[model samples]
Target: MPKKWFQNWFNSPYYHILYQQRNNAEAEFFIDNLCEYLKPSAEANLLDIACGRGRHSIYLNKKGYDITGIDLSIASIQYAKQFENSHLHFYVHDMRYLFYVNYFDIALNLFTSFGYFDTDYEHVKALKNFQKALKPDGLLVLDYFNSNKVLNMLCPQMIKTVSGVDFNIHKKIENDKIIKTIEFEDQNKPYIFKEEVKAFSMGDFKLFFEQSGFEISHCFGNYNLEEFDPANSDRLIFICKKAL
Candidate 1:
């Protein structure tokens, strides 16, 4: 397993943009869809794991749910804390050992952030941690890339600008894994970073959630909460429930 190289996000314009756009057009879609699906209590406590910058936390808090977000990145936590309403709080912590058993009524892991672990074993460990943190019969939602479609819709290179910096991203696929190389340029200086992981299929994730003690409640193809077909989906959203 390759080590995760996530440190570049702070100075990397690419990551900064992603962090700033944390509450972009997709925010309402994810918030409304998940809320509608879960029907969370006005008083329910929701956990946003890997919640970089707390966009989801802010939105859910506005809707009257008590939200607590956790992220491994301190910078991201700082960004998230900016939107803290009375009902929202954020911490820098690992989601793999949440330490809050039977606690959250709803938990969300969105935007393909769930697979940064070094190994499949560790991946499942985090899943079980999510299971542990959820109240019995609580809902857990995951928004991820549709692996099937990702394989076909793969892009080799793309350029985008964010936070007044230009980013050049390159992707390489090798043996069920994706290698993402990012080059950030601001004022003619270039800084580069890399991160990669083995991408698993939806069936694999379903088995993972099952082994982690969750039952699939729903799966969607897009941000609009539409049904997913393996061949055509741009996104894969899974709404699961803790097995009673």
Candidate 2:
């Protein structure tokens, strides 16, 4: 069987290099707003599922929470582990499997991390894993793209030069998935990568959360926690709770 696009693209060094300039301020602001809105206890135990490089986990730890960050990429975990302390931990683990049962006050699947699977069952399985990892009534914050808005404003192609590397990117929606193809060169070698994410709508997420034994507590449009408008918002942020 061929390797999954995510496994190949995400584990590549060029992936990090291409996205190295992602907006950190916006991410930090979102984290701050989320924490303020949720108001977990000062010492609450948190889990960051699919936590690439542990940036959000480290920030949460700095805010006095005990955080465990897990990702499928071994390289990412190894790099993230360098920031580990008594209150923060990093592990290489797949999201479809439960890491701990009834163990966390909060579980976060941020930055559109939940929809890479090829099948609906796989997506549901990952959600169940997240639900099982949380205590009864524990919170889950799932940050994903607003598929409707994204499709309306999709940019088909672009070229970016970052740190002396030129990246050519193409995007399209096909078979209900948003596909991004990236091509670049490094050290005189040509490389290509593809990312495919399901264009899941709000109704789809509602059904998934219900089937996974979670109750949607809140939904937001953007980092500032604005009301969600399917046609206008840039984000689909759901705050759910494990069913009691």
Clashes of each: 1, 0
145-243 in candidate 1: lDDT tens per residue?
A: 888887787899998777667678899887678888888766787788876756778878988988898999889988888899899988889989899
Give stretches of model 1 more than 4 Å off: 1-3, 10-14, 18-23
Q: Which residue window of length 10 is worst by lDDT in model 2?
A: 19-28
**By TM-score, how accurate is candidate 1?**
0.91
Relative to the true structure, how large is the alpha-carbon lDDT of every model?
0.81, 0.92
Question: In model 2, which runs have C-alpha deviations exceeding 4 angstroms?
Answer: none
Which candidate gets the maximum lDDT versus the true structure? 2
Give the top-scoring candidate (TM-score).
Answer: 2
For each of the candidates, the C-alpha root-mean-square deviation to the true structure, in angstroms, is 2.3, 1.0
